[model samples]
Target: MIGTAKYLFGLSVGLIALLCFAAGAVIDRRPDVPRAPPPDAQEVRAALGFGQMALILMGTSSPVSFTLPQAWLDGVHSLVSHGKDNLAMDGRIDGRGAVFRVSKRLTRHGWLNLAFRLEETSAGGAPRLILYAGGWRAPEWLTAALLRMGLPLLGGSQELESLIPAFRAEDQTVQMTARVPRALVGGLQAVLGSGEGGGVDLELVRAIYGELLAGAVLEPEPDYARIVRRAAMQVDSAEGLKAALVALTMFTDGPRVLRLAGDRTKTPPCALTAFATRLHGRADTPKHWVLSAALTMFMDEKTGRAIGLWKELDDSLPGGSGFSFVDLAADMAGVRIGKAARDGTDIDKVIAGLRSGRPEIILPSAVLQLPEALPHHQWKRRYGPLEERRMMRQERLIGNLLDRSPLYSRLPPSRP
Candidate 1:
């Protein structure tokens, strides 16, 4: 009886080791996806335009269907994955369903890959999403089991339903139809329905850049207000102004704008010093956060995300610079600028004020009074979450200051 028990124990140990070895083999580290080349001027221009147009379309109430071509998706992917190779995605639509494969590098020696298919099904007389998941690093049964246990907790299905109300899968295409604001539907159709064929008009972009540079001599260190004024003066139509705004916000980093113009080597170091300086200044707010806040003006629903991302990033930093209300003030300034541009009214009046070259016209003086930086622990102790009363009061103070300013006051009322 003792010998039999020992034999059973040894067999169990061997089986466990074998299982671990098999699992390791399945999850072994492999070479990451090759780094994609950085998007060139044209690709960047197209992607930025598409994003802006998409946001505008999403605001409308008209239902429209559009197909995204593979090339366009690739450009967007390249732009989003510019400096990283740890994550990659490939998606396709077939008669059966829409399928996507996502790969994420989890560690130095392991990668997790997921393949999922979404099919539209009629259940209880309502269209529902049916998800089918497969695995690359694990067995199919294990992957399905994990997804069954995980997706409910993650609320993945509900989110998808909310984002995509209706979609039809065909060969090499998934056509999505959603209700957008009616007024913008025609314009959206003209721009988005063109697919990859609609490349950005570089000539117009160059003209906008030329206008910006023309005023540089008078105000060598033009602030945000000056730059907007120059662009607004050059673009007479709403569409043209939108294009100009998209170009301005495309790169939060000023040097990238110089590179976009052409070879950075040929451009003098001080050529766009003021423009670049303004972007990186203001209490060390991350450039990406500034970009997010600027972009959120078009999609008002995402304003909270921009604010949250900024606070989250500030919290992650070590040392004295935790969450800075000064940085928040700068972000609010950008958001105000974006909202003014989006309103497409009082362009003449706005230009007149900006032409005065008063920085205070756009950024009120009260922003200077906000605390520069507060460590995370201290910020929590005082303000708690961002929506807490103290924080809201501080934001209200900034709003009142902006309301009292000339530039922001001219525009219609908008969300902070």
Candidate 2:
């Protein structure tokens, strides 16, 4: 009887251990593990091609890092070499399927642009982005090209690098400014601007780039800002300057841009309203004050003083965001949907009659996302990367939009 009891206890303990392991498998969901992008293995090999040039390239920024283990280094080196070996500046990535020649249309912009190299996959297969080299500096010619052809800034200083575990030390906040050749940058710009067919952001990209990326303060240099802002205008083919002017009309007494735009066409008051509302203020609330303001604004904490939250700006504000900062407000011409669903209105069809724009779709898809018991932002600070922080902020912005819109209940909270 004693031996049987001991055996039973041992089995129970083992079962508990297995359950804990299973729970861990469920919870330890990192993006990289599941969303590992397919690399063009052959193209990777070509990118690494360097018969004679290999010796000279060593002294520069070593891709070698202590953080990156040895075996991995050998693998990546193999990949880079594959491209360098078989490929030339003009060679097609997968010559059999579709050749990815650098577009001449992009060349005029100069060197300070991310050279997006296209690699050929199997025949009829989608092209894969294999080479993320070049685009570190802009030459005089490239700058001139931008001026002449109107290619403005796209990537900011903060985004010069990204999360490359193999090349970086411990993964905190380090922008691995790729030390690619200035000429290489210029070459890429030429290819992209050449416009034969390089899939760069040909249109104005209104992405809200954040500064917390490098954990460093970006000195106020209006040159890049001006370039980017103007580029944003150029991409949409709508005058961003004019959009700014149109947005400024919101403050004026008469009907705003949305109101006037909605007058002739089926643009939603909210569609134009979002653009006008974006002009409200550059609402850069600090982290702590955001908490206080939330308690005040939503929780009805009279002392919360969300209005005062704007007053207490900490750390010079890492790119202020508001409820309605539409990076693409200029693009909101007409709605393209048939039936409206938000707050039970035909706003979708109304907007569709006006313009054909893709609507923003939001989803959580995580069980943890549903649980509001723990403060997510706080959790992110404790263990999240800068990207996670930005994601959380974006989630908050989406929530704010829903709360304001008549579409809160219409949005399905949970997805299968």
Q: Mark the regions of model 1 whose C-alpha exceeds 4 Å error after superposition.
A: 1-203, 214-219, 222-224, 250-275, 278-293, 297-301, 304-316, 343-345, 410-416
lDDT per residue (tens digit) for residues 11-128 in model 2:
5765554344323322221211111121232222232333223323333433322211222333233332221221123222222221122211112332221233323334322223
Model 2 ranges off by over 4 Å: 1-34, 37-178, 186-377, 380-416
Candidates in order have lDDT scores of 0.49, 0.25
For candidate 1, lDDT tens digit of each residue in 75-128? 555554442345554555566456655455656767555455666554311123
Question: Against the correct fold, how does model 2 do in TM-score?
Answer: 0.20
How far residue 368's Cα lies from its native spot in candidate 1, in Å, is 0.6
